[model samples]
Target chain A: MKTINTRRTIRKYSDKEVSDELLDRLLTEAARTQTMGNLQLYSVVVTRSMEGKERLAPAHFNQPMVTGAPVVLTICADYNRTSTWCRNRKAEPGYDNFLSFVNAATDALLYTQTFCNLAEEEGLGLCYLGTTVYMPQMIIDALNLPKLVMPVATITLGWPDEQPVLTDRLPTASFVHYETYHDYTPEDINLHYAAKEALEENRRFCEINNKETLAQIFTDIRYTKKDNEAMSEGMMEALKKQGFL
Target chain B: MKTINTRRTIRKYSDKEVSDELLDRLLTEAARTQTMGNLQLYSVVVTRSMEGKERLAPAHFNQPMVTGAPVVLTICADYNRTSTWCRNRKAEPGYDNFLSFVNAATDALLYTQTFCNLAEEEGLGLCYLGTTVYMPQMIIDALNLPKLVMPVATITLGWPDEQPVLTDRLPTASFVHYETYHDYTPEDINLHYAAKEALEENRRFCEINNKETLAQIFTDIRYTKKDNEAMSEGMMEALKKQGFL
Candidate 1:
């Protein structure tokens, strides 16, 4: 395994292309990763074509990486395969449930992360476009996805042009539990920020902004209900339409 | 990256002890894997003590690996650290949402997979216990986990006692999509099995007892609602209590 210091998100990319051979290799390794019952409940949609990336970019909040990167892969939660297996065996198909969605979605995301690690090991930069799953229809139309599949997330890969700083992390003890679910009290939260402040040493995303602590800043930006309601609605609607809800 | 064929779950461990230096390196490297916004919104709880395992085994469905393995680690979904960053600057911590849960959970799971991959590279056999997260209280009490620190999963590391067959996967076409979600007709299901039969030459999982198509057996299992309802309900309830719902 590569050292942690070498790992960082590569937003900018070199003009170099990620070949079809490499794509296949990565997907195959991804498939080899663990999944529930060896069901292989997910698939990676490799988007290297210009036309494909053009449509996929807008669906992911106009993220430049979606099209700008040489390689973009979308991991999807799939139920259609299992459903079809049931029909052929003359058994009942019942995949539309909260559990199945979580199971498949979890599998897809795990595979995507495995692929990302492999890409990084091969000297590539990558970024995961979390919003890709929200605009299911546009991406589906762009990528020509089959039925019983829904987007979990999209990852963009290429050689890095920019070196982003090591982003902030929560404290160690604040999150690690000895045994049970350890709820964070106000004091615990305060201690975490103090440590983060030490790490930041007054530095903002890059420059010193003299802003609120990382906690305050992120909370304001991350937790507002308005930021995600539409995205959630779109995802659920897409799933329902696909008979996966 | 290690070759895929070498990876296996180690259930029966030898008396040989795992070094703390290796354990620390594992946690450090694993924690550094990519996460949304570099949130690093998770932590690893490591246990090498016999007493610790004794307490944790019951929480994890009494899997022998929990107590038997030389090393066991639990990955957690953490919001406390992020919430603290908010409160430190006198800001409201609003990261408790479905999206937050999804992001943190995915991040934790990704880190866990990377850790597993790393462990495999080091010649360790790993069995990921998917049931750890299902029973929160047992884990919390056993591990002394605090609130907002939910258990995502557990893993036991040692050597393999069982060499399970390399499980077959649904075809690429069965799960992969070109652009959108594809609807599967009855024909699609039969066609997938036909291709698999050709590849496997009669060696299949569902067809072991009789001549059955992959489509028929899995469809019957996946489409049933009653099989997994209790487990699903328990998981949702645990999440809700953790402020995830």
Candidate 2:
């Protein structure tokens, strides 16, 4: 509980290396996480070598943590192994559709979060690179991922070299609904975002980005509509090429 | 770590009701989980009333845990609140796309796993109902979820009435790839699944189902191709209806 409460995304890592044994133990335990029907539809690719990290860095948009962290893990939604086993046992496999991909992705995310908590509990820090899904084709090629396997997320891990401040979250009332969803009113939205918009750092961010409001920075600069649509197209194409569409 | 290692899904629940205060604290803390740019594209609907659970039970195929547990949480991948905030802040939101839905779902799943761990640590037990996606339209109508708010998974939570044995998992090597993915050969597949196929319980399961191999049970009965394909069609329609496609 303490670890979950105090955990932060660590981008900077020390020179200390994470031993193979420790990584193995934590990952082994994390695999115990619940899955749909005991069919663990996930696989993790461990990138420890410099060349491997360099290959993946471009996929993650050259994030410095990709190269700095001693270990980079690419969590993937995998049905290949299970499918193969089914075929080998004279049972036809049928997990090559959109819903199957969704289920596998959920299993992969559950395993990813479980591993993150365990790694943090062991005094290790990590950061999730959301770019994995945005440029999944690059990751799939770099990792030689086969059909029925898609990269969902990436984690850069090592001993923490710095302590980052805890990020802010909207009040629980912002997201928690009782009995049924109560749509947020305009007044309710204003009340919920007051603290966030009032943050000094956020104001500084808006000024530096030359944006009128913080949301403009996100829509106009960071996650533009044009970019999101293009990426969505690419993602659909990749999913089709991977036999999941 | 011990809590994680020993945690098991509890389906049967004691009648002791979970207090609102305790649930609030855990949900509030779990909201601190990492998200894509801290956008927190997730919302949870807390269902405590029997009528609410009954409304959701059919969507989950009338899973005993749904109506049996003291509380049922429908974890949703929501872009409505964030998009609403952006719109109210004089920013046009362009998150009505597939990539946005994927990112929101990832955030929701991360929150779900974090909450499960925290809840287990507090001596509460829970089970994840994967059927949430298989029949999402039913849940959407039942919960009155607005557009851009799609239920991703459901959790049945309460005090435990039974302590089931820990479920089995494949050996770590079966899924953990070093440097890059090493495709499993036919021999490797046999070697990895040998123990699972040899398990007495699994063998009995196959015998009862009148299947020759354990994999047949999954391919034929549990997750058949016909069902997966039909569900995929429904899910896509639901996504389109939810303004995510």
Candidate 3:
């Protein structure tokens, strides 16, 4: 209960310092989570230096959270380590399949979640930058990422500068199923979407910034706007260039 | 340290039934550590009956853990819920993007971690069945999975019948990178692969297991195994059929 209740996305941050001890403990906790075959196919890049944060900010659409947060960590999917291992053993590296790529990416994300939970338990607020995928090349170049390594997400950590109100949730029934998938009819769509739009509007998260509902805000700024379609489209080519696909 | 240190996967069972109240509390905790945007794009499928266990056993390659554990939960990505909301708003349901699929899948896996941690803190051991992807069609059909809903992974939870030795991890250097993807030389691979093989030889996960070293096990069992290529190959086709891809 303590762990769950203490968690909140603190987008607003003061000039607070996250101690090294806390970061170490957080990484250790993240390390304890399961990895595929214990290969541990990911790495966390911690950045507290202003220069590093500056380099990352543009890639994340200049999201203020990146520069404002006391600590920023990038979780990366890394197949380079395993590839090296395969080479040493005189065997071909088996990263040709899309399955391997997905597995490694998922493993990296799982590790990120564990780290996020650990940080939250320590009273730290974090906001995950989901836009990293759109700017993978920028992040890779700025972070000097090598072949077979990709930045999946960036997480900003800092003490809460403002209290962000909790967002509303879709009813558990909307998602959970007993034995199988439940098809949604038009009525079901209306009910769920109406609830979602209302929640987005009423959500207190925007209140911290003294704004209207996110739904209305999204009307002006499409959240799914194609800001980086060209880059993501080039991802397959990038993977081929890296000899990973 | 508290929430994290308390986590342990439980596989052994006491034949004790989990009450509805307890299950509710557990699910609530499971839902707590989810991703923000409050999209909550995941679901939990709880299988309690012996018959359900019987069905799940074969789906998970007849793993004894499914039958032994008191609870078997399958975590799934649910686009159906979000699509319904779109339709109700007289909007096109575009939950078919690969990005959305990855997001929901990540959310489901993250939720699984939270639930697994909660269960462990409650003194339950867990065994995660990674075979979910290999038999997607069979599992989906058996679980009555609807369109736009797919299983990510299945976990079996219960008290421990045996005290398995703590598994050793590959040297941290083998996986963790400081700033970028580090060059893994041939020596690194040989050392790591040799170590991984040695560890697998002594570990006993279950009867009739592949039981090879990490390198051999993954190579023979996961990478080279050719039984289930059709499922993944057919996945794109299925998505196309469902108007997803």
Candidates 1 and 2 compared by TM-score, better number: 2
lDDT of 2 by residue, A1-245 (tens): 58888899999999998999999999999987899998899999999999999999998889899999999999999999999999999999999999999999999999999899889889999999899999899999999999999999999999999998888899999999989999989999999989999999999999998899999988898888898999999899889888898
Model 3 — TM-score against the truth?
0.85
Per-residue lDDT for B80-113 in model 1, tens only?
A: 6666556556777655555667777778888888
Question: What lDDT score goes with residue B72 in model 2?
Answer: 96
Provide DockQ values for all models, in the order shown. 0.47, 0.86, 0.40
Docking tier of model 1: it is acceptable
lDDT of each candidate versus the true structure: 0.69, 0.93, 0.67
Please give the TM-score that candidate 2 achieves against the real structure. 0.99
Clash totals in order: 44, 0, 10
Docking class of 2: high
Share of reference contacts kept by candidate 2: 0.79
lDDT of 1 by residue, A113-142 (tens): 778778788888898786765577887667
Best by DockQ: 2
**Positional deviation of residue B140's Cα in model 3 after best superposition, in angstroms:** 1.7
Root-mean-square deviation of Cα positions for candidate 3 versus the true structure, in angstroms: 4.1
Which stretches of candidate 2 lie above 4 Å from their native place? none
- TM values, all candidates: 0.86, 0.99, 0.85
Off by over 4 Å in 1: A133-147, A166-174, A180-195, A199-202, A205-210, A222-225, A229-239, A242-244, B47-61, B133-147, B160-165, B169-174, B179-224
